[model samples]
Target: MPFTDHERAYLDAQHIGRLATTGPRGPQTRPVGFKLNTDGTVDIGGIRLSSTRKYRNIRERPDTEVSFIVDDLEPDGPGAIAPGWGRGVEIRGRAETLTDTDPPLAPGAFSREVIRIHPRRIISWNLDPAAPELRGRTA
Candidate 1:
């Protein structure tokens, strides 16, 4: 599915997103710097990426269902969860880790190793010009 302008804006505004993957021990999650590719897939990179738990989880279970989320306080205050006060996105998709180096999408992320995500189900809240509510598609 294609991402809306608001969704893309919020995603681009944030630098780090939480990645969740299930492995042998159960579900695991970690925060990592990411970049949005031109094809709509999410690219992840970090130091010692291949050795990280999130990377290992994806390698161990390529079929693992992954969920990525990026959200934050509205602004000057911490009360960013009152009613329709949240701004961010949740992406449910399949993920995999690779070692092939791709063209640089951003700085500070590992170039040799990366986690790529193909979003199937996605949702966004409180980010719209006309209607700032829930928006997205589910598979």
Candidate 2:
């Protein structure tokens, strides 16, 4: 609910994100295909999702904080005046394994479990454009 219109639009345009999870050794980050749910949660679907280290860490520590990031990158051209830095949104949230789905997302996968991220905070830089619906909102 806290996502501004531009932020929402930016997220809606992206398909992949990095999910950072706490591990026994330290922190582990993995690229995950995520679906932005209508209820404002990110659904991370993958084969053997329940057996992933990210899932295991979250299961072991329900209060674990996970950071999800989706960015738009462009390479600086040969004569570009300014360096091109990444533009994207960073979302920090809590994660949980969801297995209520009947069919597995991947072919011949064992479980239909998905990681759901509940966004607690979102930070973005040059990642959103001024939108009509976001006229009075802050990015």
Candidate 3:
């Protein structure tokens, strides 16, 4: 699997993530909504997805690499401070623009077009309570 059980669980629980991609101008990063596919790939979709720069970046250069991350601060104690513990998963991979796929990733909120990321590397931190450090490896 591209992700460990803990990493998968963390990703599955999160709704928002950030995607970074390079375009003619430069690199661009934006907040996005994603879904975890059964094959362990990530499917990013949004309103007017195909017209977005991120989607155009992939469509322009099919091999364009992308980075995606999902993270949050979790309370460390019953009354933890405002800044809590940090945990997240980062995925780096090549992305492709998929248009008119079967059932849309998110029906009402997103379009049928989506950016699918095939992970080549994965980095995770604090997902496993037993190990609270950054861990990375090629997928």
Candidate 4:
């Protein structure tokens, strides 16, 4: 599914997410600190000297699945029923490692290594009970 404007905006608002990759062993997932660029790409930073399974997987195959929990809705008032946590957004796309030669990393974030995700689909759902209006939507 294609990404909607709102969904894109939501993804851009987030600063961190989990990245999933397939390796020779099996599927692997890890927490990634990220930054969303205006061009609609996600940049993940980490040390380049280390050799992690995720990095290795990307080296083998660039295709990956990334997801992040953006928001969790909760009750705000007394006597008001509490709403469950809101659903998160998941993105499936091809990932590529960025080198220092690429558009240099942003300030404060270590720029030794970065992975960019080019999404092909976006999936989201609402986890709030009071908000039955929340339903899974694909884009």
Winning model by TM-score: 3
Q: Least lDDT summed over 10 consecutive residues: which range in candidate 3?
A: 74-83
- TM-score of every candidate relative to the true structure: 0.84, 0.77, 0.90, 0.67
lDDT of candidate model 2 versus the reference: 0.73
Steric overlap count per candidate? 0, 0, 0, 2
- Per-residue alpha-carbon lDDT of model 2 for 77-128, expressed as tens digits? 6632223766677888888877766332353553577888898877776544
| lDDT, ranked from best to worst | 3, 1, 2, 4
Tens-digit lDDT track of model 4 for 87-137: 456666777875662323354446466677776565654433344343444
Worst 10 residues of 2 by lDDT: 130-139
lDDT of 1 at 102: 63
lDDT (C-alpha, whole model) for all candidates = 0.79, 0.73, 0.86, 0.59
Which candidate do you rate higher for lDDT, 1 or 4? 1
User: Model 3 clash tally?
Assistant: 0
Ranking by TM-score: 3, 1, 2, 4
Better of 2 and 3 by lDDT: 3
Over 3-86, each residue of candidate 1 has an lDDT whose tens digit, in order, gives 877678778888898998987889888988888777888988887788888898999889877999988756544433344356
Better of 3 and 4 by lDDT: 3
What 10-residue stretch in candidate 4 is worst by lDDT?
126-135
Comparing 1 and 3 on lDDT, the stronger one? 3
* Candidate 3 residue runs with Cα over 4 Å from true position: 77-83, 102-105
Error of 2 at 122 (Å): 0.6
